[model samples]
Target: MVLLDMNGTFLFGGDRFGPNQDYASTYRALGGSRLATDVVQTIIQTCFDTLEVIYNDPTRSDSFPQVVDTLRALPAARGVPPADLALLERVIAQHELGRVPDDYAVSLQKLARSHVLGVIANLLSRKDPWLQEFYRAGVLDLFAVTVFPRMVPASSHRGSSSTKQSVRWGSRAPM
Candidate 1:
């Protein structure tokens, strides 16, 4: 069996927290036109800042709050309807998750013919968007197992080694 990380590996281009991010444009492109650009920008920055705090902490390496929850808690998001907040989460995910290229999908298919493929990804939001992308790329069924942070319960210790083992061995370990 082969294990792989999703971001920066098979998938690329998640730059939501990068310096060149333009949150407002992404928001508009994704049907978010009610909020002003500045407001969108502020909300995006706040999300980034909050995630950065958690990501930068060595002790919090394996823990993360859902991105949608983070967006909902922002002052800039005040009065934004739940539907809009959901859209905002997608906007943030758009910047954070890249696409699976046709070439990579082809490669994955080829690799899966000989080796069992599995995805071990750490995502701040739900895995639906990435799953949709995988389905779109026609590589969703290529994996023997897909594991994301939210799919596993929080452990007392850091890292996901035990969780990975449980999933790989077919243990009913809350995954």
Candidate 2:
């Protein structure tokens, strides 16, 4: 069974600031506001944290707000103008998920003709916005299986052994 890691393997991830926005430009756009390198790192880190928080407890709605509150305490957000924060919020709302290239659909279409395509991602969820992303990208049906962290025990979330186990146990088609 051929396996694929989703990001960078087939889907190229977007910037920390979200779709169509790059980090440098985002930092520069902050203008007078002083956003420290560490704060920027925190912003990026928060992206990952948000996913985990969502995965662990899907009912929580405070992840983004909590992150912003923390950023507000740092120089990164000190006196941050409303407009800049709005942009940041927009980026955060996007979940920093990247766009799938046109070629990916074409390639997936071809690959599915013979090989059984599946995804073994550190993806946070298998539900909407996430799963819907694949649908929106027009490649949802192309995947025979999609493995996500929430689908397995917490220990399996980051290890290769767990990933292999997920692929083995989670697949809809035979491996």
Candidate 3:
């Protein structure tokens, strides 16, 4: 069996708000035209900032909230309707779940013939979107097991018995 991290391994572009990121355009493209560009940008930035806070703090790792829930709770999002909030969530997913190339799918197919493939990914959203992408790329069934674990804080797992045990024997940690 072969274990692999999803992001930056075979999957690319899940990180949001990089230097080249353009929140305004993504907002407009995702049916956010009703809102001002600056307003959308603020909401997007606020979401990113909120995620940063949760990600940087080890205590919050276990209970990391979904991006949509965080947005719905925000003062900036108070006036935004539920539909728009859903749209914003899609926007975030778009930026986070990067595309899979055709060649990568082909390679995975070849590799799966000899080795059992598994995905151990840390994703902020539900696995449906990622699963859909895998299906779209023609590699969904290639992976025998897929574990999308919640972001675990490094300090929490350091030298822990469970961590060592998990490394020795894989577990289907929830998505």
Candidate 4:
């Protein structure tokens, strides 16, 4: 099975880009304010809590100062969503290829040519719309299996002692 992590795997993610305009604008219509650092902080704290549960380690906490320092260093994230320091740290990492590796697409295409290609991923449901962005970007069509976490039920979350219960992937050719 060709398992791949989501986010930086097949999609361009991070705080540098604004939210899906439709969604963001809708939130605005509903009286949403500028995304605050606290919102970002809560996301980080949730990840840390999940990690703590996994490792059973309380000492493993995140450093906000370090994150802030790192965000200031990213050229693309300057000025917008100023509170995305944590997003900056998590999203910026070396991947199999640039942003979305060319080799990943090539390899998936090659694999699909002969074998049943599969992708098992741990994903968050709230982020599913971004998958469509990759489709628009022409990267989603290369996979035979694309797993996401939204498909899982609340009961399944405890099955593997992991926060994620299931992945949402496709058997159909990427569209």
Candidate 5:
């Protein structure tokens, strides 16, 4: 069985893309003024909204690459220069092309005591370097498969806009 994290775990949103304390750091690094959470949230939402449009398109069989393109082209992310973009892209790639959160080990160790697991997140980038970061973060050992952008074709079940697949082991006492 496999378990996924909500938002940044399985999906993408929340503090991962700013809208929190990191917002000021990122905005300042990118040469912007102190922006409000709403502004930061708008940028994040715009990218996702654009992704939804591209992925949900009936004519396009592949949407992951397009999602990558759209994210790189976002105005909020523009002027960030190729180097910085590369860094941000690496973060997206880590999840999209790499492994799940670090916390998965504990859960997996509980279920089956030897059961294996993996991650399948919908990200906005498609690069192999992204996966490398996950390895550096020790997320590659637990999961057998790490589906990410450009790795899996955009279809009903897989792609950059996919959802988390939950796996329920024998019920235990509530937390």
Candidate 6:
């Protein structure tokens, strides 16, 4: 059984979330706010840090507010005002719940042929957001199990830990 990450590992975020592209869409999603290069870096760093906190502690609540609170305190916020945290969450949730690139589908199809696949996403938004993405991408049915924070609140799933003791473990049966 192999566990996969849902956000970046599986979803490319439609190309705005990779090398040298931290929080790319997020800048625009904040509503026409042009961040200075250094400020953008701070925002991106803070975003990742906030997300890690969520992943590290799934039981924690008010995650969106946490991100906002952290950013609001940053010196960068003075130059490039932080977007409305609620709106920020809404925008990210929208992307995660929307279309996945064709490459994701192709890769999933190949991997599913011989192995059990599961999605372990450490999301800031509610679990429904990711489910909406997987369903819209038509790859929701491919996974043996899709674990979200709501379902597996205690999982320390970063990668390949194979904590089979966790929730909803799947098995592959003989044909």
Best by lDDT: 1
TM-score of 1: 0.80
Ranked candidates (lDDT, high to low): 1, 3, 6, 2, 5, 4
Q: Model 1 over residues 94-142: C-alpha lDDT tens digits? A: 8777899999999999998788778887676667788888889888888
Against the true structure, candidate 5 reaches a TM-score of 0.46
| Ranked candidates, highest TM-score first | 1, 3, 2, 6, 5, 4
**Candidate 4: tens digits of C-alpha lDDT, residues 1-175:** 4555655665443323223213233333434456454443343343333433533433321211133343454443356464444333333211111244566556556766665555554332233444554465455655566654433444344434344433345555543
- Whole-model alpha-carbon lDDT for candidate 4: 0.42
| Residue 141 C-alpha lDDT in model 6 | 70
Worst 10 residues of 6 by lDDT: 160-169
The global Cα lDDT (0 to 1) of model 5 is 0.47
For model 5, what is the error of residue 148's alpha carbon versus the real structure, in angstroms, after optimal superposition?
A: 2.2
lDDT score for residue 126 of model 1 = 66
TM-score against truth, every candidate: 0.80, 0.48, 0.79, 0.41, 0.46, 0.47
Evaluate residue 21 in candidate 3 and report its C-alpha lDDT on the 0 to 100 scale. Answer: 75
Best by TM-score: 1
RMSD of each: 4.4, 9.1, 5.6, 11.0, 9.0, 7.6
Runs off by more than 4 Å, candidate 5: 1-24, 27-45, 56-61, 66-68, 71-80, 87-104, 126-139, 149-175
Instruction: Write the residue-wise lDDT of candidate 2 on 1-175 in tens digits.
Output: 4667777877776434433335434455545255565554566455545555554674432222233444455454667666665555444535445667878878877887788877776543323344556777787777777765334544334444444233323324655
List, residue by residue over 84-162, the lDDT tens digit for candidate 3.
Answer: 8887887777777876788888988899878878888766665678889988998887776776655333344554434
Cand. 6 Cα-lDDT: 0.55
Task: Give me the displacement of residue 68 in model 4, in angstroms.
Answer: 24
TM-score of 2: 0.48
lDDT scores of the candidates, listed in order:
0.75, 0.54, 0.72, 0.42, 0.47, 0.55
Q: Model 6, 25: alpha-carbon shift in Å?
A: 11
